[model samples]
Target: MLPYKNEGEIRRLEGLADQNKLTNEQRTELTKLRNERKAHEIQVAALFDKDTAKLHSELEKIDLKASKPMTVSTTEPI
Candidate 1:
């Protein structure tokens, strides 16, 4: 299942589990759902880290370009 779908289902199950007593099976299911959600969260965080590194590299290139001095050419008869 997609991460968002797993997140929604996890929330729903948590609400239900909080409201009433869970049977052994339901408790086991809840534990599995929680682990799945945590795994997805870790995957998402890794993706974010990759994106952030790419952005930082691009920003550094821009800064280097901005910091360089410009040259001016003069063509005139003297």
Candidate 2:
């Protein structure tokens, strides 16, 4: 029996070929789907980077606050 991994890969390739069948309509549809998916991935990456930058900036502010010495009240002894 073929290994499961090999079987899965073969099946996946077959599905790809089937999806990209020789008909012009199938080809066009495949191209459209692929392009849309690529565009979506780019948009997601940009958003992720923007969010990462914002989080890093916030963390830096927090770290700065943490590094400063705090004043203790005269009534309170450490």
Candidate 3:
């Protein structure tokens, strides 16, 4: 998923499966890889949700400040 370098073994196994020629070992490996992919997907999604929530919180704080009235001070430069 992160896209480093893989040897395309999954594709090889799938191709073999299409022909109904996959070995037992290959089937096990494919299942393991599929499960790992699911776990990675879940972890990435959780992180994204957390970051989104923090961003929304910060935006809300800024919005609240903006909604308040501003007062001018004589000591402040125009």
In lDDT terms, which candidate is top? 1
Q: Please write out the lDDT profile of model 2 over residues 1-78, one tens digit for every residue.
A: 112323444455447678764456645655666666566667778888999999999999989977787756523787
- Residue-by-residue lDDT tens digits, candidate 3, 1-78: 353133376677788899999889889998877677677778888888998999999999989977877757533688
Which residue segments of model 1 deviate by more than 4 Å?
Answer: 1-3, 68-78
Q: Which is better, 1 or 2, measured by TM-score? A: 1
* Candidate 2 similarity to native, TM-score: 0.62
Q: What is the alpha-carbon lDDT for the whole of candidate 3?
A: 0.77
Error of 1 at 13 (Å): 1.6
Candidate 3 residue runs with Cα over 4 Å from true position: 1-8, 68-78
Mark the regions of model 2 whose C-alpha exceeds 4 Å error after superposition. Answer: 1-22, 71-78
Which 10 consecutive positions of candidate 1 have the poorest summed lDDT? 69-78
- What's the ranking of the predictions by lDDT, best on top? 1, 3, 2
Cα lDDT for residue 35, candidate 3: 71
lDDT of 1 at 47: 89
Q: TM-scores for all candidates?
A: 0.69, 0.62, 0.66
Give the clashing pairs for model 3. Answer: none
Ranked by TM-score, top first: 1, 3, 2
Model 1 TM-score? 0.69
By TM-score, the best candidate is 1
